[model samples]
Structures are given as structure tokens and as C-alpha cells.
Target: MLYVLVKTKKGTLVGNYSSDKAGCILGRSSSSLVPMAGRKVADEHAHLEERTDGLYVIDGGHRAGTLVNNVRVKEYGPINKDDVIAISDYRLQFRFVRIGNNEEDSFSKRASILPVKSVEEPSPVNNEKMTRWREKIRRSLVSYMDLRRVNVADMDDDALRIFTAEAIDRIIQDHEDIDSEIDKDELARQVLAEAVGLGPLEPLLADDDISEVMVNARDEIFYEKAGRLNKSEVTFTDDAAVISAIERIVSPLGRRIDESSPMVDARLKDGSRVNAVIPPLALKGPNITIRKFMKERLTADHLIKFGSLNKSMVSFLELAVAQRKNILISGGTGSGKTTLLNVLSNFIPDNERIVTVEDAAELKLYQPNLVALEARPPNQEGKGAVHIRDLVKNCLRMRPDRIVVGECRGGEALDMLQAMNTGHEGSLTTVHANTPRDCISRLEVLVLMSGMDLPVQAIREQISSAIDLIVQQSRFSCGTRKVTSITEVNGLEGGIIQLSEIYRYSQRGYDKEGRVRGDFGATGNIPDFVEELRSRHIEVDMNLFGGAQESEAIQDGF
Candidate 1:
């Protein structure tokens, strides 16, 4: 006889099931017994059976679906005995205990063993035990004040004591249960060690000094601080715990990762970007990377203040957007591509209808006429999935004045370029490329992924005509992300696309603090749309193209 403990929303049931006599227990509830031989009943039914290593299954009935750990299960499958299961509106949790085990039975247990007269033999005793057990469990739980005292006493040192206390407070506010005892001291110590290990990298994330976090396993956790890679001492307990923590973080956000699905990309509440992968694909235990965002959305003024761009350069960009120029922000990964895109998007009119698409929705637009769309992963059965390309094609019918793609990574590049050419002017997007020249090549490669057989020249022609400006940004060694070049496409010449730099960042000498010093300056060639900015009463400084003296003067004021 196998003793089973079943907990459901209505109550609790302590019963036993025999595989030989019942074939398999079938019922909508613990009280109902339906045979499992008929086609309808066989297709949809719930039952429990022992499996190796403490696992069981609560199969779904035909009309009602089964859920494991609150996640809906599409078919019959193995589940751990401690797993929480849900069927339709009701939730059930199961635990398997061997009869005559040495451990003392919980308060919920009725007697040593109930006689198996029928399936309903223990019904009366089950009800009495559930009520008594709930009260006992409630009293055994610890209070928040007790947890705070315990965590404070466990602090090993001064620095850790302060950090642990603050971290514990944050966790308490974030978690739902205050009465549940979770060994707060241990939790606090672990989380504090995690934060301290991050070190200077923590300030970079909070200061908005960095834009991306890259971790190549536990030994190497790097962040793009000030547009350059900065190494930090962030370490995890072990590869297994790192994988477990990453899974815990992503799963709560409606995402999953395991051997079956080894790769996952997710976003944090603050719009930080996250990507994680686990072994056998990873080979390492599990790898996680996060790209932190600025607490405040960067505006044109902020760039000017940071000396990344001058007022004249800002004026030129503002006019370029106002004139409906299709702009592509190009950079390597973690080079502030999205940050620059967000800053430039501020120039978009407040009243024009806009549509933004991304794999994970991270763009924060202040425009009232904005609609954000995100891609969806397929269900477990590999159905009901939506891709970025599908969203791009559908955006065409949405009557958008501006179409903003958070990033063009796949076949959607072709559709986006087509959208730009077909009157979706002022469309803004970002792409990962080493330089402006590489951006065109990346677009061509992505267009080919669409399965379109257009010639290379035709693809280049489409790129040149569709994109008016390429703003290249990079993270320097000092961890600064600056707009390196703003080049205009001068159309195709000699079967090659011509690019002329309108603005460029000239490297000046480093500052007193040994940081990279640079100034944004124009190259003196008149843009095709110079008259458009002139119409807006925005003047360009001719000396901006002359020499370092003018650029130096502009930097001193900042």
C-alpha cells in the first residue's frame, strides 16, 4: 500500500491507491471514482503513481487541464512529489510518505495507518486533521521582527553588517510573506556577499555609468562602464547555484530554462537586459549576463552635459529627425546603441502615432502616441508562437507615423528597410555592427535571412536609399560610450555606397582623472538637408569643422 497526501483548495485527503485493483485511480476530485478504460475518460483523467526518486504525476482530466508549479502542462508527464499542481480553478499539492517510516508524522497525519475498506475510508479523519494542522503551521511560522534580529546578530563584520541589513529590508519589502521563517540571517548573508562581490560594478549599475553587463561564467563578470569593459570581482557560490538562481529569477517573469530549453533572454523591471544559458549547450554550469539601463531616460541635454555631443551636433540631430530622416544607430554589443536610440527618439513629435517592437520590451518612450509590442515564445507543445518578423509585417497596417524597432536582429531587417522606403520616414532602429561600413553589411546579411534572392547591389541600393543617417557609437577603454561618427549616405557611386561623415569625435588628451577625453565636431561637408535645419532657425558653427581649439572651448564650458 502506497500512502499519499493530497492537498487541494477545498480541503486535504490522506488516502492509499493500489495499482492492481483500481488499474489507476480516476476522478475529478478525491471523492469521485471514474473508470479509465473509455475513450473520453482515458483521454482526460487525473491519477497518481509512484516513480523513481520521489516524483509523481497529477494527470489532467479531459475537460480540466493540469498545471505543475502553476505552469500549465499540455500532456501527461512526471512531476516531483513536492510539486504544486493545479487543475482548472482548483490547486493541489501532493506529498508521498512511506508507511512505518521512522520520522514522526506531521500534525496533518490521522493515525499509524488507516484500513483500506474502500477509497472513501479516511474521508472523516482527513477533514479533522486539516483544520488542526493549519493552526499549528501558522503558529510555528516566524515573525518579521524576529527575522530582523536574527539577521542583525549573524553579521560577521562592519561592512557586511550594514549591507546585509539594507539588503534584507529590500527583500522583505519585495517578498509577500513576512511570517514564514526562511532563515533570514542566511538569506541576508548570501545576498550581501553577492552584492559585495559585484563591488565597483554595483555603483556602475546604479550610477547609470554602465550600459551592459557581460559574464563569461563566474570567474569573469564584466560591465560596460562609461562605454568600456570594466572587470569586477562578482563571484557565485558554485556553477549549480548560479544556474539555480538564474532559473529562479527568469521563471518568475513567465520564462523558463532547462536542458530542453537552454537559452533565454529576459528583461528586468528597470529595463535592464538579461540573457542566460545553461549546459549542455553552455558546457559551463550556467551563464547569465545583464545590461543595466540608466535610471532616467537620457535626453539630448544629458549628452551635451556629458560632453558626448555639442549643442550644434544636438541641433543637427534634432533637425534631422524633424525632417523625417531614417536613422540607424550602429555599434558593437554593449556600446550604448539602445541608449543613443532612446535619446534620438526624444526628437520624435509628441502627437505622431508610433509603434516600437523588440524581443523584450525595454524602450521607455515619453511620447503619448506610442505602442510597444514584444515577441512571444512558443508553448511547450511548440504551438502559438509569435516572431519579430510577424510583428513587423503587422505594424504596417497599424497606421503608424513612425516605426521604431528596438533592434533589427533577424529577417525583420528586410521588412524594416522596406517600411522605411515605403513612406515610413523617421523610422529609427539599432543594429549590432563594428562600424558604419559594417552596418550596411549586417543589413544585407539579415535581408538574405528573409529568403529574398535579390542581388548584392540591389540590397546595397535598398540600404543606401532607405537609411539616411548612420550614427556609430562605441565604448572606449575608460568605459565611456560616445557617438564616434555621424555619417550620411550619399547614395550609390561606382556600385559602392558612399558615406560622408557629418560629425566625428576627435580624441583629445585625457583629463586629470585619466579618463578618455573627446569632443564632437562636424566635418564641414554640407548635408543634403542643411536647408531644412536652416528653415528651423538652427545654426551650424562652421568652426566646428575647423580644428581642436573650437572643440576644446566647447568642452571647457561643460
Candidate 2:
């Protein structure tokens, strides 16, 4: 059922509207299906079209702009439930509630994984005297800056930190009521973090060992190191302080988060992915999760050292990429799919033109002839939005020898496969799947998601011809991620796509320390394409095939 919630400046009203065969019009005019009342609303502001695949909103070419989730959009659809629609002076929660009756699959039918939560860890510096001293220093710092009419935003970063640190020092020394036993330097750092940085998160962000930071609430902060979760001993002064830190992270990006848009996805200047959730949905408080990007670029040798794969696997991947064989990296979340994709990307020779497309620019490709395109979120006015599918389609015209997509999450899967089949061969991408067989099924599902009316057999044929290899990277329960298997997309026969496993990881068992005990071995089954294209100057070490005759005979009659 489709539900429409009407919100005015005075209050909110719960109501329902009947859907017409053509579509529903949301505007101020009485004739509009959902007659919005406001001066900013146009007579026919936007049209909502419900297709078999999903619901889409098309702008009526109005200058005010049509919006979804506070994002001004010209034409966007498949708007999932729980999404807020903003028009002129009105806000509406548009939803299609399907409560477990799976008569048909829809947005609400998909399962969701909630953010990780941990218990609050008390700060070691959170003493009564120290808290008071820090609060005093913060107040004094604000007064000093205001008296001098200092514009923190305009000041150079280096100059600002130095100036703030010195001012904090002066505030501490001028006040004798403050405890001397308190580490003055640490106190100053805390004050500075509160004043100019991400409050308590500054230290975690600065630590080289920390990979992920989670803020469940003002007092609950957790971090990840070497795949182990540990609660941090620091926190924001309050919920408001937590919101302030979020603003600081997003302000430079010209992004805003508030009641209308309580959820946001962003990245730090260093490319670390950051996500924030605020009130209404986030009951506890403002929460932030930051996944730090690799500071040092990793190479294939690094993967070898990390045991993500062996020398033979890396050699085959390097050759596969160089030979213009389209490769897909498959894994679950946090399974190091992106890391492996990044390492394998450098395998592309510097001489070729490379195009990288992503939702947020993360791939740090060093190729001189590289064109990076990042998908853009809708502007505040709901305009100027670009999606991964559009980027994948447009990059084809850019004459790139290799197309590196950061990840394929939607209809873009169809376009990516088409690109690989149409001569842009050495393209690389990552997909969310548990195993190589599941990877094939996942691709089929994603391709069908494109809303193309093609038959299943046709899609299977496209997959078999388009993709050459699949590298299955997995994160074991032991908090370690490594390549579990590498398979070949041999061909499609009957109605099934045939797969041959080239390399596989055999896990004997977990060691005494709980670390995964596994070794990588080669599957004797070789790719038919390798044998057919032997004359193409691409060399494959035949000896590597003697280790194991890996049968991905798992899902193929094709």
C-alpha cells in the first residue's frame, strides 16, 4: 500500500490518496491529486509515475525544483519507502508498506543490516576536576577568539592549529583553580579537538592503527583495529557537540544533515568514508561511522605478504588484466574487495587510458591518462545528480582502454556487462556476494534489476561472454580476509553458465589463536578462453594448474 503523510508548518496530518492510471500530481492546484498548500509550490510541480519496477518522480520543469529526501531531483525514481518528499513548503513521508505478504517483491522486501552498536566506554580523562578544567579552557578560548575577531574558517590549517594550541595553553596557565596534576598538553588537545576538530574522534582519526570508528552515542565510541572492536575512552561533551562534529565534517563538502535529512553519506578529505544518522531514526543520538581508507597504497606484493592471495594468484590476475580480460572481485562487506580491486587496478599498464567511476571517489589510480568520474548526489534543489549507471554508460564514449567501476550496486550491472562485451575489455569492478557461484546468481539478479525484459537465458549468455574471471575474497570469522577462490566464466550452454575454478583456498581449521588457518592452492581446471587465446601473447603458467582441478561445476548446465 502507498502512504502519503502531509506536514505543514503548523503540524502533520495523516492522509491517503487514490492512485490514477496515468500518475499522481503533487502541487498547490486543487486539481492536483495531492494538493500541496504553499506559495513556493507550482501548479503542476512534479509527476509521480509508478512503474512495475519502482516509483519514479519526474520534475515538471519548474524552477523551484522537485525534491526527494531533501535532494532536488529533476527525474529520480524507485524512491524506496521511508524516503521524505519535499515540495515547496510541505514535507511528506512517501512509503509503500509491504508487511511480509510477498505477493510481489518491492523495496521494503529487501533485508537490511543495522549499524554496529557497542557499550559505552568511560573515558580515562573523564574526572570531575579535569572535566571542569576542560570546560573552562573551552569557554576562555571562545572569548579570546571573539575578542580578537578571529575567523577560524579563513585561517590557514597549520596557522589555525598552532594558534588554537597556544591560546589553549594560555587559558590553562592563567587559571590557577585548574588542577596541575592534569596533563596540560592532553587537556589542550581535547579542548582544541572540541573547538576545531571532531571532538573526541580526533585521536581515533589520527591513529594509524585504527581502521574504523563508530559513535553509537555521545558517550559511546568504538573503534576497530586489525579487525578487532574496542571501545574508545573518549566522547563528545553532549549530543549537540556530536552534531557539531558532524557539521564540521560535512560543511566543507557543502552537505547538510538535519530533521528533513537525518541520514548522510560522506567522505573525509583523506577519502575515509563517513556516515551519520541523527534524530527520529537515530533514537540514541547522533551517530557517526568512519571507515578509514588505506593511507599507504597497497600493491600485489603487499597482498601476498598479507596472505590475501599467493604469488601464483597475483601473477594470473596481473596477466588477466594485462590481457584485457574483464575481471570482477566478489566478496561480502568489509571483505577487502575494494582493497583488492585497488591493488589489481595498478596492474593496468600506464600507457592505456583508464576511466574510474564511483559513488564517492575512492580509487587512487596513479595512471597519468586517467579520467575519474564520481556519481553526484542531488543538490539541495534536487538538481545536478549523476548515478553510477549513467557514469558507466557515458564512460563508454570516453575511449577508455579500461573502465574501473568502484562497485556495481544496481542496474549498472547490465551496462557494465555490455561495456565489457563491447571492446572496453580489461574493465574491473567489485560486487557483494559470498561465493563465486553466488556471484553469478547475484549478477543475474542485478541484471534483472535493470528492468530489461530480456529472458533469463539471454542474460546468462551475456554474463558468460562478458565476464572472464571472478576473484572471491572472504573475511573469515577469525577477523581475517583472504582470497578464498578464483573462478573462470568458461561459457554458457543450455540455460546455465559454466564456471571453472582456477585457484581455491582450503581451510583446515582455526588455529589456537583463533586466526584462520588456510593455504591457497591452484585448481587444475584452466579457462577455455586461455587455451583459445594462447596465440594472443598472454602467457599462463601451466604448472599452476596441477594443484587442484577446481570444479565450479556448482551451478552450470550452460
lDDT of each: 0.65, 0.77
The runs of at least 3 residues in candidate 2 whose Cα sits more than 4 Å from the true structure, single-residue gaps closed, are: 1-132, 536-538, 548-558
Q: On residues 290-377, what C-alpha lDDT tens digit does candidate 1 reach at each position?
A: 8876665678787777666677777778878988999999988767788778888889999899999998878888999888999887
Instruction: Give the root-mean-square deviation of each candidate in angstroms.
Output: 21.0, 22.5
- Candidate 1 residue-wise lDDT at 266: 88
Give candidate 2's error at residue 438 in angstroms: 1.3
Task: Check candidate 1 and list the clashing pairs.
Answer: 44-62, 225-479, 226-479, 226-480, 227-475, 227-479, 227-480, 228-479
The ten-residue window of minimal lDDT in model 2 covers: 109-118
Model 2 Cα lDDT, one tens digit per residue, 1-558: 554555442232212333323367877666776655445678888887877777778888888887888788898878766677777656665555444534534322221100011122334755445566777788788899999999877765534654676677778778877665776756775777787778778667756567789999987999987668888766677788789899989878767888877887788978888999999889999999998876667788777766677777888888788888999999998888888888889999999999999887778889899999988777777788788999999999999999999999999999999999999999999999999989999999999999998898999999999999999989877668888899998888778888888899887676566667766788777777678667676566777667843322111000
- Superposition TM-score, candidate 1 onto the true structure: 0.61
> Clashes in model 2: which pairs?
72-381, 72-382, 72-383, 73-382, 492-558, 493-558, 496-558, 523-548, 524-548
Cand. 1 Cα-lDDT: 0.65
Prediction 2 TM-score vs. true? 0.74
Tell me the number of clashing residue pairs for each predicted model. 8, 9
